[model samples]
Each structure stands twice: as structure tokens, then as C-alpha cells.
Target chain A: MSGLLSPGTKVRVRDDWPETRGPCHIRTPHYLRGAEGVVEKHLGAFPNPEDLAFARPASRLNLYHVRFVPQAIWPDAGGEALVVELYETWLEAA
Target chain B: MSEVLETPSDRLLAAVRQLLTDKGVVSREEISERIQATDAATPAQGARMVAKAWVDPAFRARMLADGAKAAEELGIPMRGMPPLGVLEDTAEEHNLVVCTLCSCYPRAVLGYPPFWFKSAAYRARAVRDPRGLLREFGTELPQAVKLRVVDSTADYRWMVLPLRPAGTEGWSEEQLAAVVREGDMIGVTFPKVS
Candidate 1:
């Protein structure tokens, strides 16, 4: 609940976990995987939907947005897209 | 030899297949079967079935409350699938799907997301700017219709049942499904006269 993950800090998506461990959606953008970004916003201590979707009542993970430049991740992003937002638990130091 | 030996997208898919094989998540037979069932012509069959619910109030009611069983009514086997939730998008609520953790999808209904839908441009912008995302999808809404973007996760896969479009007073089932494009079913597009 108390940490200094201010804006422009390096963060990585914990990709090594089992495939079925987090929230289940149709498509997750490839850019944010195992990548780094800056913390643009913080939504506070809510049950991170990534884990909460599975009804993990006990294990609560904080969520935030880690922003990434379009070109940095996508080769042909054409620099038209904005930075990405990855939850806190989904990201850590790069 | 097939002139189209393999495209870049094909290679990517094959690589994912190989990775899945190595990871023990699926067998060669499993991949083959899944591929066999997937093709452009026949896309999102079961999800379309859920779409049919809108025309029929009874079915629509059932779909909203019991998506899984409603899917089963149409013979869409969902066993062994992860926790699945069908978010029916109404005129009041506009639902959008995003996988922040991984690209986990409900293959049983909606086939595969378009390459663009799985792109960073879509994932980040959908949440950061909901109206803009809709604009990209070519479904501009009045500032009055409040948009609510729902970011999905790895715990549960989502399928959106878009609100039935107006002007479809007596359209048959097939006529209705024709306008339900993949994007429409995903809550990105509004049903249109195709």
C-alpha cells in the first residue's frame, strides 16, 4: 500500500507465471509483455482484477498504469499509439 | 509445394503452437483440432448464438443471467474452459475487453481477436481513452451515451453481447447475425446494415 513507484519508473510484466493465473480476457496487447514503462496513474488498493477474477479473496495485488511509448514495443506502431497501462502487480522493476 | 508455404502470421502461429507443445499446455492433435475448427468463413458461431438473444427477450434475459448455460443451449461446449463471463453490452452500458496479464480469450464463442485488437495501440488506448478507441473502431457515440471501458484480466475470459441495433424490426435471425461483426460482438462496433 506504501511504495514509491512514481512516474517514469521502469516496470516489467511478470510473464513467467502460469498462463491461467490472472484475469481472462480475449486479447492482451503484446507490447506490454516483459516490457518496461512509466507509472502514469495509480487507482489505489483495489482487488487487482487480474487475480480477483479468479476469486482470490485472500491474495490482493495493487494495480497501476505503466506507460510505454508505441515505437519502443511495436516495430510498426508508426508512433501513432499512446503509452500502455499495466497494473502494479502485473509490473515490477525492469 | 504450396506456393503459400507460410506467411509471417502463420509462422507466428506455428511458433506459438510449438511453444504450447513445449509448455505441455496442448498436444499436436489438440492444436490441429483447434485449427480445423477455426477459419474466417465460420467465425464466432456460439458467440453469435448469444447475440441472437437480443431479438428474443426471453433469451436475452437468460443470456444476461446465465451466459454459460445459454451457451450450452446452443451446443457450445465450454468444459475445461477457464472462468468465463459474458458481458452483455446494453444501450446504457458499453463494455470493452482487455487482457492486461496475457491474451487469454474465449475461443469457444468468439474465435480469435483481430491482430489489431491484440495490439498495444488498442490495449492502452481503450482504457486511457474510451471515446477515441470507439472512434478508431468507426462507432462514434454521442457524448450523451456514457462509455464505460472494462479492462479484463487473466482470471476470466470475456465475450461481449452488443446491444441489438435499432431499425432491425422484423429481421430474421440470419439477417441479424450478418451485421454482428467480430468487432461488434467484442463491443467495439455497433451492429450496422451490412
Candidate 2:
């Protein structure tokens, strides 16, 4: 997932869970799914924990600091914004 | 006639610890040593860094640039700890740190995680309603000031470099540090001049 997205890249979180959600463990929060945010910065690459959770050989995945306006996530949320760290696998080009 | 039982998480932790000890992966002494080191740290460590940054422009720049390195310059041991990220609070923007997934914190500087920091309500509402949470903490910001909540969801740990209180210009670094509290460094409240 490295070199796929840089800082300030616009991306959206995948709303649906993968069909093979059997043993793969996801670290991203459930509320962030289907959310739109811009990459605040690149947090470097780490071994994909979804595979690591199962004690499997894992490839590195790029982690990003993504910023979302409050309204983008919850319409009634005020003017504040949220910045969450997400792995590359959880994002798609917006 | 039933007896109480250990929670699943507690049982799991005990099992894992026993397994690790049995396998010789990590000795019990090593775990105790790490826990002792963490317990030795306190919010005063973070306040000291903030006070130094407040007095020296160069140190402030370095602290904002790289928190772990800046902490080391102040003789704070950061070895084997995650990178520290300092969030500077301005009149225009106030910064807060929360780990929605779990309580990932700057324990190297701030000691153990506060009870409220690990609460489920804080994790769920901090991102959803930051201003409301701040208000609950007795922090009332002006309507115009934009609140930015940074989720420490990854390897990096974060702390807030709160704005220096007014009327503290002539105060020494130690004096300034005395005024900076744990909540101030956490961005839930501001440091008081007195």
C-alpha cells in the first residue's frame, strides 16, 4: 500500500466489510466506514495487523493520518474536526 | 452455590502471560521492570517540557518539530517508547488527543493512563462531539475557535503543548511548570496564571 497515496490525498473509507472477515482483524473503527477525509500525513508502513492477528505472514501497509470535518462524519456534529490513523487497505480514492 | 469468575480479558491476559513465561519469551522480572519504569513517570515530566518550550524559542521549535528528540534534550528517557507528537494549541485552534480504538497515550511522559481516558464514553463521544466533551471537562471555548481532535490510533503518542498563561511572562521555568497540570497537557483544560 506504500506509494499509493501521499499526504493531502482525498480518500473514502470502505463502507462494507470484506467477505473473508473470518480471521482477519481490523483495527479501524466501525464508525469511520463510509467516511470521507483527506490525508493529513503518512504514518509510515507497518505489517498488516489483519494478517498478523492470525499469526500469518503479513505484508507492510501504509498508515495515514486522515482528517475529517465534524459534519462529514455526523451531520449534527459541530465545527470540530477529527483526525484518525487508518491503514491503506481501509481507504479508497474519493 | 456459584462463585464469581474472572472476566474473559483478565483470563486471557493471565493465559498469555503464563504462556510467555513458560516459553521464556519474556521473564517476569523484565515485565516488572517495564511496569516500574512506567509508574515512575508523571505529568510533571510533560509540564517540564512545556515550561522549557515556553521559555526558549529554539526549544519550542524543536519540541514542535520532534517531541521525542526534544524530550531527550531535557534528559527525559524515551528509549523503547513510541514517538511523541506535540500538538501546539493557539488562540485559533485547540488540540485534543484521544485513542478511539484503545488508550494509546504518552505514558513515557504522562505516567499511567487516567481512568477517564480509557472510558468507553470518552472514546465514542470524543470524535463524535468534541466540543461537548470539552465542555464536560469545564473547557468552554469561544464559538470561533476550531477544535481539532487527534486520535492516537497508531504508533505515535500525542500530547498538547498548551498556550502559556497570560501574566506569567516573568515566571521561571519551574514556576511555569507548577502551573501546568495534567489536564492542560491533555488539552481538556488550560493552565491558569495563578
Q: Compute DockQ for each candidate against the true complex.
A: 0.07, 0.62
Candidate with best TM-score: 2
True contacts kept of 1: 0.02
- What are the runs in model 2 whose C-alpha is more than 4 Å off? A1-4, A18-20, B1-33
Q: List the residue pairs that clash in candidate 2.
A: none
Q: After superposition, how far is residue B25 of candidate 1 from its true place, in Å?
A: 10
lDDT per residue, candidate 1, B58-115, as tens digits? Answer: 8777776666667777766655555445666656666666654446566667777678
In candidate 2, what are the lDDT values of residues A1-94, reduced to their tens digit?
A: 3366877889998896763565446778777889999998877788887788789999988888899887877888854778888899888889
lDDT of 2: 0.87
lDDT of 2 by residue, B65-135 (tens): 89999998987778889888899999899998889888999988888878999999988778878888889
**Which structure among the candidates has the greatest DockQ?**
2
Whole-model lDDT per candidate: 0.62, 0.87
What is the Cα-based TM-score of model 2?
A: 0.86
